[model samples]
Target: MRAYETRRGARLSAALMLALAVGACGGSTEKAEGEKPHAAAADYERGPHRGRMLRDGDFALEITLYEEGPAPLFRLYAYQNDKPLDPKGVQVNIALTRLGPKVDRFTFAPEADYLTSPAIVHEPHSFDVAVSAARAGRTHKWTYASYEGRTTITAEAARAGGVTTERAGSAMLGETLPLNGRIEITPEGKSDVVARYPGRVVSMGVELGERVRRGQVLARVESSESLQTYSVTAPISGVIVEKNVTVGGITGGQPMLVIADPTQLHAEFFLYPRDAERVRVGQPVEVTSLAGDHRLASRIEAILPTADLTNQTLVAHVPLSGPTETWRPGLGVKGTVSVGANAAPLAVRTKAIQPFRDFEVVYAKVGNTYEVRMLEIGRRTPEWTEVLGGLEPGTEYVVDGAFLIRADIEKSGASHDH
Candidate 1:
C-alpha cells in the first residue's frame, strides 16, 4: 500500500512540474542590458534563468568580524533559492550597511565542489565590519550591518535594551536538595486550651479574632443528651488560637476553646523518609516564617515515627528559642535542617518545584539563563523537597514563576532555528 501511494504521488508531482514549465514559457520577460526588445511570442523561446532560481534553497552561513575581538558573530540561514534556480553556479551577493548607509560588499569565492544534496549548505565567511563613527565633541556612535539579496538593515542607532547574548563555557552541575518545611509552632502545644466534650454551645464569651487568656471562660455549652450545662475554659495559658465551637451548635468531644502558651511556641515540620535519615535530634534548623521577615535559629528536637497517613510524610519537630512574636500557627513558612553529612546539597524554595506525573521538575538558574531540570526527589514536605540529584547547594534557582521562566527558555531555543 505504501509503495502504491508513493508512485501516485510521484505522478502527481510530475504533472504539476509540466504545468509550471508551460506557464513559465507564457510569462513576460525583461530584455538584457542594451538589447533590442523581442516580440511577445519571441520571448517565449528563452527558458528560465538558472542563476535566480538556484539561489532559493538555503545557506548555513556564519559572519564574524576579522579584527574586532569579542564582538558578537551573527549566524543566519539566508533563504535564497526561492525562484527554482540551480545553485551550482549561482552568484552570492552580500552587502554590508552601517546606520542605514552602504559601507562595503563581501563577495564569497563560490565553489561548486562544496555543495551537498537536499540543497543544504554549510559555510563560514568572515569580513572586516567597520562603520565610521560620527564624532561629536566627546561622543561618538557606530553601527553594524549585513545583507544577502536586498539591503537588509542589520542594526540601528545605539540604544539600550536590544537582543544581547553570550555563550557560556564550562559550568558546575550541582544537585539541588529540598528542605523539609517551614517550622511552625503547633497550635495544640501552646496556650491553656480545652475541648468541649459532648456538649452544645449555648453562648460565646469571646468574638472571632479576639484574644483570650488561660482559665478564661470563652464559651458555654450544654450536654447534648442530658442537658447538663458546661463552661468551656482555656486548656493552656496562652492566647486563643481558635474557637472551634460555635454558639447554639452541638459538638461531641470536639475542641471548643483553643488556648496555647504564646511565649512557648515551636515550629513543626515534615520531611520525607529519605531526608529523615539525614536529620539528627540535635541538628540545627534555621526557621523562617512566611508571615514575617524574621528568622529563628532552632534545633531539631525529634524525628517522629509513623508516617502521616494523609501524606506519607515523616514529621520533624523543631523547637525555636527565639522570641515567639514572629512565629504563628497555620502560617506558611520554610527552613533548612542542617544535614551533618559531608556532602551537603543545594536548597531551593519549595514553590519553585513542579510535580509532573511521578517525578518533579525545578528550574535551575545557570549563569544568566534558567534550565528545566528533572529532580530525583528522595523526600518532600510542605515547603521543601530533598534533591537526590539534579541540583546544587547555595545556588539560587527561580523560586517565583519558575515555570514561566522555563517556558521562556524553551521558546527562545526554538526561535534560534529560524
Candidate 2:
C-alpha cells in the first residue's frame, strides 16, 4: 500500500502516464508541430507545472512535489512575472496538516532547481499544505490539499460495499497457555457401595447404570453371622455404573455397585513441561469442547499427583462450572489458561489490520473519509493487537471489510506512485 497524493496530483499522474504510453505506441504519420497544443502565456501567469501557486503582484511562487527516495520532497519555484527569479535571500516554510489533527512544519533551503525542505519526508502524504515565502520585503502564503491515499464514500455506498466501523479503544488481553484436557472421574465423584459384613445376597433391587439416592436400598442380604436379613443401601447419590452382586452369591465383603456423578465430571488439563512451572491453582481457564462449540469456565483446582511419564505432561484438575452440553467422561477438550495480562492504551481486532505502505495499518474513518494511517504496533495476540501510535482513542475506524476498501482505493489509483 502507498500513500496517495491529492486528487489533482492523481489525475496529473494518470495524464502523464497516458502520454508516455501514447508516445511509445505512436503511429508512422507525424503531425505538424502546429497540431500540438501549446502552453499559452496565461499558463505561465499562474506558474507552470504541478504544485500550489501563490501570486502577490509581480512575484509568483509555485510549490511542486516529487518523490525522491522514501517520501515526497517539496520544491518552491519563484518567478518574477513570467521569467525565473533567483531565490537569493528568499525564505520558505511549509506546514503540513495531517490526520490526528497534527501538523508538521518544514523550512526550505535553496537547491539547484528549486528550494527543498530539509526534513526526511514519509508517507501519509495527504494533507493540507500551507506554503509561506518571504522575499523583496513582502510575504505570500497559500494553502492547498495534497490529498493522497484518501477516499470518501457516502454512508449508503459504504454499506453497499460491506464496510463496517468500530471505535478504537482499549481491551484486556491475557497471555494464553494452550492445553489439552479430558474429562474423567475424580476421587470425590466416585463412590463404592459395599457390604458392611459377609452375607448371602437374597434380593437385588437396583440394576447396573441405574441412578440411586443416598441411603436407598440397593439390595437385601441375609447375614451369615446371625442368619438375619439386612438392607444394603447406596452411600452416595449418583448413577450406578457397576453392579457385581448376584442374588444367590455369598459375599466376603466386596463392593456391590460403583456410583459416579456424571453430571459433574472431573476434567484434567495437561500442560507441557515448559508451561507447568507457570500454572498454579486458581488461575482463570477456559475449557472448550473438541467440536470448538461448547465451552465452560473453571480454574486450576489442583495438580494431579503424578505426571504422564510417556509424554512428560502434567495434569491439572479443572472442575467445570455451569451446565454442560455433550460434555461427558473421556471427552477431549481444549484448555486456554491465563497466566498473565497485558493491557494496552489502544487495541483492535487483528482482523481489522491491513498491510499498507510497508506498515501495518487499519483504515481510520473520519466521517465519510477513509484515510491510511501507519501504525506502530506492540505486543499482539491472535485476537487483538496493541496500537502504539498513529491512532487516537475513541476514533471510529473500519473493523470489517477493510480489505474491500483497500481494493477499491487501489483501483481508484488514489495513492499509486506513478
Candidate 3:
C-alpha cells in the first residue's frame, strides 16, 4: 500500500484500540430501557479456543475469527441457557468501518458449527465493528473497535532507548561486479637463481626463505670441467622462496634459489566475457578476504584478451595499492569491481530496515508520532538502500535501534490481523 494510506490506517487503528477497550467493558446493548451506563459492566471472557465470549445470564455467544483462507472469516456459535441454540432462523449483520470513511457490510448464514460471514473481509483489519443480530423474536446490537499490533512511544522514551533518526540524503550506488581472484607473483617479481653451467657445489651463501638483494651470491659452485668455483647470484631482490643447492651437493642447470617479492604481487580475476568489456584500466576495485571481513583498495591494471580454455572466462589483473602483507600469493579473495553507478536522490540506511507484516518497512518519525511506512526499494547494498517510494527524502527515520519499535508493535497485538 502507499504511505498515505498505511499511515492513515495506522492512525485509525490506534483510535480503534481505545474505542474497543471502552466499549467492550460496557456490555451489550440489550441493557434494560433507561438503564444507567455503569449499571453492569460487560463480563466478556477469552475462551479456551482463543475466541471472544459474549455472555448474558445462561445465553452465550462465542465469536472466533479464521484467517487461513483468502478472506477473514467471522465464526459465531450461539447457546441458550448453556445449550446449543439452533441458529437456523437467526439474522446477523456486521459493519466494518475503516479509514478514509470506507465501510463494509457482511451478512451471516448458519453453517455446520457456527455462522460464517457471507463475504470475505478486506484488510487493515483494524476498524470499528458494529454487530446486530435477531433471533427468537429478540433483537441485540453491539459495537466495538479493534487495534491489534500497534504501539506508541514518546520521542523522549525512544531517545532513552538508544534510538536515533536521520533524514536520507542523495548518494551514488555502485553496480558491483563481484569476482573471485587469487594473489599471484607477476613475472617482474620473480627470478630464478641459476648455476649458469654444470658444476659441483662448493659453498652455500643463502638459505631458503632468506631475503636477498639483486646480484647477491646465493651459492658457490665448482665447475667440474674447469675445476673452478663460480658464484650463483640472485637475479632479483626478494626472499628466497625456493632453494635446490646444498653445501656439498653437485648442481647443473638447476636453479639454486627462486626469489619472489610478495610486495610486488598482482591479483588475477576471471570474469565472464560480458563482464570483461565493462572493466577498464584504473577502475576501482575493493579486495576483501574470502570471509568478507577485511578490505583493501585496488584498481584494474590490465585486462587479458584471452579467455580461459576451461571456463571460457576472461582474465583481469589488478595492482594492489594498500598494505602488501594483507595480500599474498595462493590466497583467495573477493573483489568487487565498480562497473557502474547511479545517483539516488532519496535513500535510507540499511540498518533501519525491518519486516513488518507482509512488507519491508522503516519507522518514520513524524513529529512526536512515529508512523510505520512501507517501502519500495530500488538499488540496495549492504550499507544503503535506495527508496523508490513510500518515504520522502527529508523525512527523518529511525536509523538505529528500530527493532525495539518492531517488538513494541507486536507486543500490542496489532500485527496479528490475519
Cα TM-score per model: 0.35, 0.62, 0.63
lDDT of 3 by residue, 265-339 (tens): 788888887787788888988888887767878889888855447656777898764566777788997898888
Higher-ranked by TM-score: 1 or 3:
3
* Candidate 2 stretches greater than 4 Å from native: 1-97, 100-149, 153-173, 245-250, 307-313, 343-346, 349-359, 382-384, 392-417
TM-score of structure candidate 2: 0.62
What is candidate 1's lDDT per residue for 287-376, written digit by digit as tens?
A: 776644887777777777644576556767777666665665556667776664332244444567765323466644433333345566
Candidate 1: stretches off by over 4 Å = 1-178, 187-202, 222-230, 289-293, 305-312, 341-418
lDDT of candidates 1 onward, in order:
0.42, 0.71, 0.68
**For residue 349, what is the lDDT in candidate 3?**
89
User: Best to worst by lDDT, what's the order?
Assistant: 2, 3, 1
The TM-score of predicted model 1 comes to 0.35
Q: Which candidate leads the pack in lDDT?
A: 2
Candidate 3: where is the Cα deviation over 4 Å?
A: 1-150, 153-162, 168-171, 196-198, 213-215, 223-227, 248-254, 305-307, 321-325, 344-346, 410-414
